[model samples]
Target chain A: MWCQSCREEYEERDAGTCKECYEEASETEEELKREIDDLKSKVAFLRLVSPLDLISTTDLLLHAAGSSSNANPNSSPSTALPCTPAVPAHRAVLISRSPVFKAMLENEMEESRSGIIKIYDVSYDVLRSFVSYLYTAEVLLDEHMACELLILAEKYQVKHLKIFCEKFMTSKVNNENAIGNYAFAHRHNAKQLLEAALSLIMDNMATLTEREEYKELVEKDPRLVVEIYESYLTRQVNTAAKDSTLQP
Target chain B: MWCQSCREEYEERDAGTCKECYEEASETEEELKREIDDLKSKVAFLRLVSPLDLISTTDLLLHAAGSSSNANPNSSPSTALPCTPAVPAHRAVLISRSPVFKAMLENEMEESRSGIIKIYDVSYDVLRSFVSYLYTAEVLLDEHMACELLILAEKYQVKHLKIFCEKFMTSKVNNENAIGNYAFAHRHNAKQLLEAALSLIMDNMATLTEREEYKELVEKDPRLVVEIYESYLTRQVNTAAKDSTLQP
Candidate 1:
């Protein structure tokens, strides 16, 4: 008879014992010792093959699985092994929260420093923004960030990033905020931003009669005044001519 | 007695002539010969002093009367001398109309072989506009001339000229002529012109859909669609926000 739990052989009668059983029991102790030794060897083998203690546990696990498949072509099915733990999400957050990162992000977000942010060799604020974006997938761009990030995008040679920034900044330059936006556009030499600013300024020209504020601007750049007047005159002339032609 | 016309020294009894009638006639002839010599010297002296022979002749006539007291600081008063014949004004006009003078003007106006027409070195056709403006105090700049002259102006660092051209082009950019003006603006990289074109395009965006000719343009630059839609949305959003805020 065989013991199912221990996988050991035994002889059984009414008493479940024999003369050979007594002698075999003494020898069974020695066999048990040998079995314990075999178990120890298996434990040693598992320790050598397992990746839990490796520098990169994920890399070790992948290596071990690949090696095992290569070693046994027709082995019985094996249980899935545990993998290395994933990188913590808070680590990225902690890095972005550093004082250095905060300063760098703040500097990059400032509109006045636009076109001067070089991401690869950038100050701490820009790096923080980049890290934050990567970790959270959240783009925190206000008007200032939108302008600065366009420059950063161009600096980093990221075409899609620049387009996204430009889209955001263009939307911000309305009649109310156009003057400040125009300043940023002029500082960075942003063509699209300038065009948007011009349109907003032109649209609101009639209402921007806070003469003292923009008087010097208009005086210094008389061409701007001339442009507005000429455009107005042109429209009036065209409308009159059109009306006359339509009257017939 | 002295003859006022002759200015000859005379003996009192014989007057200005000899006792014999034949001698008197001879004496008169001698006096006349001496007067002719004095006149010839006077004419030569007058020609040396005056730039214009006609003016010199008039000076001599006036000074010989002894009635004129005016003295020219530029030249000594004519010494009661015979006048010289005036040089014709036709000579000055003839020189001005010469082929050499025309050639010099043409050379000054020709575009440099280097493809740069400095505002200072622009050809007669372009310069004729400036000259005409100077003479008539008019600001009539033809469309084609304005465009070509702008290129010359930009090349020569003439900011005023460029501004003038931009103002002219801006006035011309309307729905009916925007396409041509847009092409010109792009060619010259004229920022003002481009802005004008953009404004015209935006204003006429609805009509553009009706025109089959501009369908390809709208398709090629999808941003055009975004610009129009966003502009409309912005106006709506602002109006809605204002109304909602005011409702309280």
Candidate 2:
């Protein structure tokens, strides 16, 4: 009989679905594609123009803290951050996007009063990308940028950006980076990344002990290393139990 | 043969896709659903908190024009327009979402100077919904609200909101309101709504001339009526030609 979808002859044993079911599947596929298109348009609509792109509309400025030595540390904020150019932002955008920013700006805080929010423990480039992501929900991520932004996202409690960074890191996980990523994920509370990294580490457990990163992890974060071994042992026990049940 | 998908026995003639093709299609469907999920999260992340919802973060005030008494005409913006409570907004959000607002606010315009933008010919509720849609890309749209917002969107060059309102209005097109929607769509340059309304109008041409809306449309805009007739004639000619071609 001819397969309705590809219009090619197939053996009776190689049948997929009945004609009615096939038609229903095709309809469902079409509906799903339509929904994707609608969702894409919504995303485009909802994405606000990054304040950094606008020349003159910024209501707040974010300075990368520790950019340089403050010559006159007691001076006004505008004069204090003398090295790195600030990542200009809007107050409304900041407060709306990050709960950390919301609390910092809404209260009678120094950042709110001065209109110059100094983001600490972050580089100028990463700070800019973080602010831009808040507006557009987009970023060009390499492994390094993803890790940095994930840390910042975690600090600021931006769940969406944290998930985005975690997904990227998870996808980039390999045998070489698995232990390191596993440690990072544990520190950041990234459950998905932790699972992915742990799984990768488990698959190469024979060589894991010899890897330099694994040694470093064992030294720096023995608790995380212990957790990984625990997970591996649990998986092994689960497999052994299943294999034993087959003896019946 | 046993159908792989419903696990039902089927006759040879009722065969659908081959097993390989079925699996590929299933994978494509899963990929599409995953894409939809990603786009949805992007949209959620990009959506800003409406300034109205957050107290004391607003930097701009959008007042619905012609609400009532302007009480103290020359009063400060904080005290001006005593009748209608202004829909508070953020300048950055307004500029990013609408080019019209950007141009009005970025330059040393009157609205920018006073920080009170008077949206003329719009009611308080519609203006509020319009502002809310800019921030969130969402609003509970009914026919009247959609029409009002469509006009506002067009005037402000918010293409996303315009398309959204047009889609809503088009879906609502029917025999009863086809003529009215057609006219509104024409005025607003809403192509989708215009086509939907025009198609409905064409389908009901037998009673078109007798309708009160048709009579009013003819009196108000004879050109639009002429265009409708032209479209109906063109459709009839095309149908006749196609029917004749099929006869062979």
Candidate 3:
């Protein structure tokens, strides 16, 4: 028989759906694609013009308190970083995007009263990207950027951006960075990243004790290292059970 | 053979895809659904807290120019719209959502100076829905609301809301509303609604002359009435051409 989809000869035993089902599935796929296109346009339309693109209308300024600034709001906004500039933003946009910002602004926090916010332990570029994401729900994220943004997203309770960053970081997890990522994930409460990193760590268990990151992790956080070993033991026990059941 | 999708027996002649292709297609559908979920959350996250919910921080007021006010900005804001209250909005949000508002606010226009915009020839309810949509990209639309909002959307050049209203209006086009909707769509430059209305109008051409809307439209705008007849004539010509070719 000929397969309607691939238009190739196939054995009847190897057949999948019937023609009616196939036609219905194709229609469903097309409808789903149309929905996706509609949603994409909606997202684009709903996106606010990023304040980074329009500085003249700004109502607030965000300074990145880099390491050298000692994370002090009292330090000059420009002097906070290695010549890092303050990111101009609108109060309404910041309030709309983050509940933390909403509370800060609406409750008359010092940041709101002063019309400036100082984000500690973030670089100028990351701070800028973070603010840009608030308005646009978009950012071009590398692994490093994803990690940095995830921390900021977490601190601000920006769940959508945190999930986006975690997805990216999970996809980039590998043997080389699994332990470090696993430790970072544990600290940041990233469940998916933790799971992915742990799976990679277990798959490369033979060299887990040898890596410099692993050694550093053991010295700094022995509990997380023990949890990895515990997970590996559980995996072994589950495998043995599956093997025993297959023997029947 | 068994149909994998329906779990029913089918003849080889009715086969669709091979098992491998079926599995791949199922996976693709799942991935598309996951993507849709992600986009939905992104939309939700980006949605602003409607100013109606928290009116204190509002920076601008919009008064609907109801019929009594004669579309005058000088009248008392409340007295303009049958005791309709002004719609509070943030200037930043208004500027971001509409280029017309951006120009009015950014170019030192009178509306910018007064921080009050009086929208002409619209009721208070319609004006409120319009401003709410600007914040949330959402609205509950009945036929009348859809039509009213479409006009407001087009006048303000809110393309997203206009398209949204057009889609709703198009879906509601029927034998009863076709002629009226056609005229409305044509006036608003709503191509999709115009086509849908035109198609419905053609489908009921035998009864078109009897409809009151058809006569009123002919009296109101003879050019649009002539265009509808011309379109119906073109459709007839095309059908006749196809029939003649098929006979060979």
Candidate 4:
């Protein structure tokens, strides 16, 4: 057992009261647990609504309680419940059958001038993934998608989306396109994306230069030079056999 | 005009050759501008589709190109477009109607939640102001809303939302509920919120002991002692005013 007051280790029997000090360690532990539970409840209650929600709710309550004559239409119908009827199957079918939907599904690339959502002159397609995630809460991110989304998120000024995309890209960084992505992120001022991509490239500098593109990429990010030198020695030995076999 | 490369101020007569520099800075500047424009175009192109849209587009492309033999209609169509058109409009209506909106319009509130939308486990009415901001992109967040939103953002694990709320709350820290909010943020392990709230409380501590709740809160976070002592003079004056008023 542990003395709750001082956080000292003690035998189970001696935990009730320290014979040497006569401290109420065991009693304090119970009280601490209760206190912790109380704090947890308070935290939970506070967590249930954000400051925005609290303010809005308070505003809503005040509006509802105020004279109806002065109440606005938006606030007047605030009490009406959301319509919860199931989305009709025919509506779903109609959505799928729509010409615009068919064109999107058919892979006929649409022009930017086509009346569609645009943020900072970015195409609607790029923002589509983020919007989709917001609506359905599902994400299917890949290396290219991750890189593109991070840029889109940054351009749109969606901080949460940018962070999420950066995190996703961080995990997907590999020998394939880490350098290119890092350079692109750096140039575009996608700081988080750049840092993550650089870290990934730096961590795997050994197997990188086997690819010609990676070698060129390494020159721009000079921090990868030390790791490249170390990996070159081992790689030379492995490639020596192939060099001799190819000798005509 | 200034040389873009060397930052040398020069007259138009010195255009062709700079006596100090080897390369013409104008050429470099033009090249850089062209590069910037190209990057902007690329960014714009990438932003057109979102990750979700990209995934669907990729799937559509693969199927259309006859590269993937297992092109199932059900799987492809369902994941294509993520959001409903009416969501943004609904959000706009919600924001225009809220009391927080009224308060903001009347300039009763200062800063407000921007861009980010917060989710909560409370009544939809509670989320009115937040949702409204998402739709109309305008809000006037007060001190109370700021603090409450910090708690809510932390609870929901919305990083960006939490950051914004904490920032707003931190700016409003006077001798009032700063200590209480600080303690609450600390207890809840909202590090950023705690830091911001604590810094505010610590800056004005003298009046802290007047409120038993604030005193207890300060006791829990003893780091605020220095600020509390500094504010003691202000607290004394306020106390004197109360005492003189009571005598009359």
Give me the candidate number with maximum TM-score: 3
- For model 2, which pairs clash? none
lDDT of 2 by residue, A1-248 (tens): 88888988988778889898899899999999889888888888777787866647677888877534444343356655637788988887778888999999889999899888887767789998999899889999999999999999998999999999999999999988888898888889999999999999999999988999988887888888898889989999999999999996
> Which stretches of model 3 miss by more than 4 angstroms?
A67-83, B67-83
Best by DockQ: 2
Across B1-248, the per-residue lDDT of candidate 4 in tens digits comes to 44333455544433322221212233444555554544333222222122122232211110111113443333345543212211122211222234343343234332233322323232233344344332222336786665555555455344444555666666666556666766666655666666666656645555546877665745666665454555555667888999999995
lDDT measured at residue A46 in model 3 versus the true structure, 0 to 100: 80
- lDDT at A56, model 2: 71
- Model 4 earns a TM-score of 0.27
Off by over 4 Å in 4: A1-126, A133-140, A175-177, A203-208, A216-248, B1-92, B95-248
- Candidate 1 is graded, for docking, as incorrect
The CAPRI class of candidate 3 is: medium
What overall lDDT goes with each candidate model? 0.44, 0.87, 0.87, 0.43
Docking class of 4: incorrect
DockQ of each: 0.00, 0.70, 0.68, 0.01
lDDT of 3 by residue, A121-173 (tens): 88888998999899989999999999999999999988889999999999999
lDDT agreement of model 1 with the native: 0.44
Q: How accurate is candidate 3 locally (lDDT)?
A: 0.87
How would you encode candidate 2's per-residue C-alpha lDDT over B120-140 as one tens digit per residue? 777789999999998898999
Off by over 4 Å in 2: A67-82, B67-82
